[model samples]
Target: MASPAAPQPGATDPTLIRNFCIIAHIDHGKSTLADRMLQHTGVVDDRAMRAQYLDRMDIERERGITIKSQAVRVPFTKQNGDDAGTTYILNLIDTPGHVDFTYEVSRSLAACEGAILLVDAAQGIEAQTLANLYLALEADLHVIPVLNKIDLPSAQPDKFAEELAHLVGCEPEDVLRVSAKTGEGVEAVLDAVVEQVDPPVGVADTSARAMIFDSVYDTYRGVVTYVRVVDGHLSHRDKIKMMSTGAVHEMLEVGVISPEPKKADRIGVGEVGYLITGVKEVRQSRVGDTVTSANKPATDPLGGYRHPNPMVFAGLYPMDGDDYPTLREALDKLQLNDAALQYEPETSGALGFGFRCGFLGLLHMEIVRERLEREFNLDLISTTPNVVYRVDMEDGSEHVVTNPSEYPTGKIAAVHEPVVRATVLTPTDYIGPVMDLCQTRRGTLLGMDYLSSDRVEIRYTLPLAEIVFDFFDALKSRTKGYASLDYEATGEQSADLVKVDILLQGDPVDAFSAIVHRDNAYSYGVALAQKLKELIPRQQFEVPIQAAIGARVIARETIRAIRKDVLAKCYGGDISRKRKLLEKQKEGKKRMKMVGRVEVPQEAFVAALSTGDSGGEKAKK
Candidate 1:
C-alpha cells in the first residue's frame, strides 16, 4: 500500500453544511425515510428515489435490511423562507440496524453531529431502537426522535410517541410523527432536521487532517477512502500520510459519491468526500484513521476504528479442485470490503484443501457464504459453524480451538467457553414456551421484565457455543417468528466441556466435529453420527462412525456396505438412460468428500443439524 500526497486546504462554507444519520431497528423504515428525504430535497427525482434507495447492495435490498452505512448529500429548503435563505446541504447517512453490525452503526454515528432516532408506530420502541438511541446519546449528538410507518393498519402513533418521549426523556410533542412510506409529515421531519440539527462547527486549522470513516476497493481504481473533513480541507495532487501506519502515497483522485463520481475541487472542513489514492487495497486505508499532510502532522491520531474479530469458524471447500484459485480470488475481493472476515488454509483427510473462515456472527457467516455462491458463481461445500473455545492444557498453557479436530485429548486441565448475554422480546402468551426452549438449550435465566401490556423482555446468560447455529431458528419456530433476539458477548467462563471428534477410516473428519459439554457429550455425539450416516452413502465396505472421548469411543454407528448399485443389461434404447443416471451419480459422488470408499455430504455435519439428540447414530448390519 502506497501513501498518498497531502491535500490542499479549502474555504469553509457554514451555510452549505448539514451532518446527520438515521438510526433505527432492523425494519423501522430508516432506509425508506432516506428515500423520502432524497425525493423531497429534489436531489433525486421521485421516480428515481425508490424505496430503500440507500441500500444499494443486492443482499440488503432483498433482505430489507441496511448492512452498509451510506452517505448522500441532498439539498433541502426551509418551509418558511425563500429558496435562497432556506438552502442547506444535508449530509445523510443510512446505517445498518442489525445488532451484528452495531460497530458499523457506531462509526457512522461518530461522523455525524445529529441523528434521527426512528421508532415504528405500531411496534413502538424495539430493543435495537433503544440500543442505537443510547449510542447516539453517548456520542452527544442532538437526537431527533421520529415515529415512522404511521400508514400501517396497526399504526399507534400516539402510544409510540408517548414511549419515545419517555425513552428520550422529552415531551410527547417533541417526537416527530411521520410516515416514510405514505410521505405524510415527511416535509416536517426535514424542516426539523435543518432547524434542530446544528451545523458543523468550523475549525481554523489548515494542517492536512481528515477522519476516514469508511473505505472500499475498486478493481480499476485503487483504494477509495470516504472521509469526513474534521478540521481542515483536502484536495487532489497533494501528498498525504496516514497517522497510524505512516504510509504515504500520491492522490490519484478525489470526489463525492453522486450517481457518478463528481470531482470536487476541494472538500473543506465538515464536508464528506472520497479520496482515490494509488493505495490499491482497502486494507491500507483503515476506518477511523486520521489523514495528515507529510509536512504538517497532527499531534494525536484518531482512534476507535477497530474491526470486530470473527468468533465463529466454518470450512469452505470448492466442489471441484479446479475452482480453487477462483474461490480464493473471490474471498480476497470480499475481504477487501469486509475487514472483519478472517480465513486461512485448512485441510482435512476427508475434505481436501479448503479455507477455514471466521465471521462476526451467524448472519455475517450466512452473508459471506451466499455471496460466494451467488456473486462469485462458485459451487461450495460448507461445514458446520463453530464458536472458538478455550482449551486448558495440563502444562499450564491455553489454546483457542476453533476446529474441534485441533483440540488436544489428554492435555486438558479445565476448559472455558464464550458466553453471551441474551435478551429475547416476545409476547406474554409465548413466554412460557420461550423459557422452556431456553432452558433446554442450557440457558441460565438472568431476569425478566414486562415491556408492555402484551410483550415481555427476558434476559438469559447462554453459552455462545450453544446458540451459534439454530437457536435463532428454534426461537422463531417456537414463537411463530414473533420474538426478537439480541445478544452481546458477556465473557468466558469455566465449564465441563470436551471436544467430540468424529473419525472415518481412522482419520478425523474436521468438518464433522464439535466442542460439547461432558454432560451432553453422549447425546450430541449420537445425534451427529446419525446425521452422518444419513449424509454418507454406502460404499464397498462398511464405514465406521465413532465419536470418541479421549481414547475411548463413546458412541458409534456404521454406514452399511453397498450391496447393489449399477443395473445389469439395459436393452431397447435404455442404455443411454442408464448411462446418464450413472453419470449423475458419479457427479454427485464427485461433490461429496470421500474418506476411503465412503462419501459424505457436507450438510450432514452442519451446525443446524445438532438441534436435538433424537437423530443420533444408527447401527446397520
Candidate 2:
C-alpha cells in the first residue's frame, strides 16, 4: 500500500504547528539531535545531511560548539493514531549549550511553547542542565526530559532517567530515552513533543503581530529577521512597522527555513519563519522588537525581552589604527546578530582608538574577537577582562568603573564589586578539590546537596571578577575535566579593592592597569611586573617596570640595558686609559638614560594582557 503525502512546509492551522526548542548542557548532543529530527522528518535527505547541520558557522563547526541559535521548520506525519494520516509542521530552535549563551536560550524559550530538556545519559545532570531547566520553567514552557547518547558504551540510561525524573518532578517512565547519535527512538521524542506540548494560541482575525526572536545581518540581503507569528497573518508585500522603534518598511519577502529558505505567500498565526525588509542598519531591526501591519497595527505590542546585563568588560583595539572604523562597523553588524554584545567608543593612551565592549562572559568575548578577526579580517587586541565596580569617593561622589584606567585615584570610601551565585556539579570524589578551588577564589559556601551516591551539587557566592579570569579553566582542570559550572550575577557588595597600575620607565601604561581585591593586589602586581620584564625588550638604557597602587610601588623588575663593551677595543692598554674609557661609557649611558624614552612594543602589551597566567591565575600562586 502507498503512504500518504507529507504536510506542506507552511502550516496555517495553529493546531497543526508545534514550536519547540532543544536545551542542554555543552556537548550533550543538541545539534546532533536536531540533525536527526530534520532527517527523520524528511526535511533533509541522506546525501545532504551532516552532523551539526543547524550550526551554520565554520568556527562553530571547528570548535564543536553552538554560539548562535538556529531556527528550522520540519514536517512530520503521524504513523499510528486515529489521525494517523494527519501531518504537523514542527519549528525547532536549536540553542547554544554554554552558560555564556543563556541569553540566547532565554530568547528562544520565549517564542516556544515547549522545550526538550536534553541530558547526557552518561554524564547525567550538569550545572547548565539545571540552569537551563530553571529558565525553561520560568518561561512556562512544557519541558520534555530526554536522555541522549544511549548508544555509547558508557551509557547509564536507567540511572540517569530516575535522576532526570526527580529533577523535573516526573516519573522515570515519562522521561524519554533516546540516542540522538544513532537515530534510535528519535521518532518517539517527536511524537511525545506533539502529544504533550500545547500548540500556540493566537487570533487569526486580529491585526498582524509577530515577535522578533532573532536577526542576522546578510552582506547581500541586509537584515534577515526570524519571527514567531503571535497573532493575525503577515504576507508578502505588506507594509510593516516596528512597534518599539516606530520604524516602517515594506516586507520584501516571507519564507520558512525547511532546512533551507523557501519562499512562502504568507506566515500565519502560530507559524515561525523569516522575514526580509531590506533594512541595512543593524540597530534598526532590534531583537525582541514587535512587528505589526502599518495600516492596521495591534493595540499593544508583545512583552519584549529584557536587555541582557553584561558581566564582563574588555577593550578591543585594532592592531592597525586605520581599521578603527572597520572595527566599529563590524561590531555594529555583529551586535545585530548578538544582541547581548554592548560597546561604546573609548580612547586608550597605549592602544589608541578602540571600544570598551561588554560581554556576558569570557567565551562571548573570545568569540566576538575571533569573529572580528576572521569575518571582518581585522587584527584586534583585547585587554584583560574586568567586571564593573561602583566606587564611592571621599567627597560624596560616585563613579562606575569598568576598566582599571577609569578607577578613581582619590577613592576614600567604599568599592562595591559584582558578585555571582555559582553552581557546580561534579563526582563525589572531586568534591574536596572543587570546594578548595572555590575557597581559594574567595568564595563563600552557600549550600551543598547529594544528587545521588556518586554525584553531588555545590553552591557558592563568588565575586564576578574572580570567575571572569580563569575560574572555569581552573575548575575543569582541578576536577580532571569532570566538573561543570553555571553562575548568575547576584547584585553587588562593598569590598576592599585597589587599582594596581603598571608603570614602565616612570610612565604608567593604562592598558596594563587592573582593579583587584586588596589581598590579591600585591601578588597581582608582582605577577604583572615579572611578566612585563620577560615580554618587554631591552633598551639602550635600563628600564624599570613597577607595579604600584597610587604612589606606592608593590613590585618592581628591571629590564637590563644592552651594554656595548667600550673596553673591547682596548688591548693591553694603560690603567688610566682603561679607566678613562669606562668613565666615558658610564657618562654616555647616564645621558642616554636621561634623554631617551623606552618604547613598549605592541606585541608586549598583547602578550602580557592576553595570557591567562598574566592575570589572577598567577596571582593565586
Best by lDDT: 2
Task: Give stretches of model 2 more than 4 Å off.
Answer: 1-11, 81-84, 611-621
- Tens digits of lDDT, candidate 2, 327-351: 9999999999999999999999999
How many clashes in each candidate?
Answer: 14, 0
TM-score for predicted model 1 compared with the true structure? 0.87
List of clashing residue pairs for candidate 2: none
Q: Return the TM-score for candidate 2, rounded to 2 decimals.
A: 0.96
Per-candidate Cα RMSD to the true structure, in Å, reads 8.2, 2.8
Highest TM-score model number: 2
Candidate 1: tens digits of C-alpha lDDT, residues 222-312: 7778888877677778778898788987777877764335687678878877888877655678777899877676777656565776777
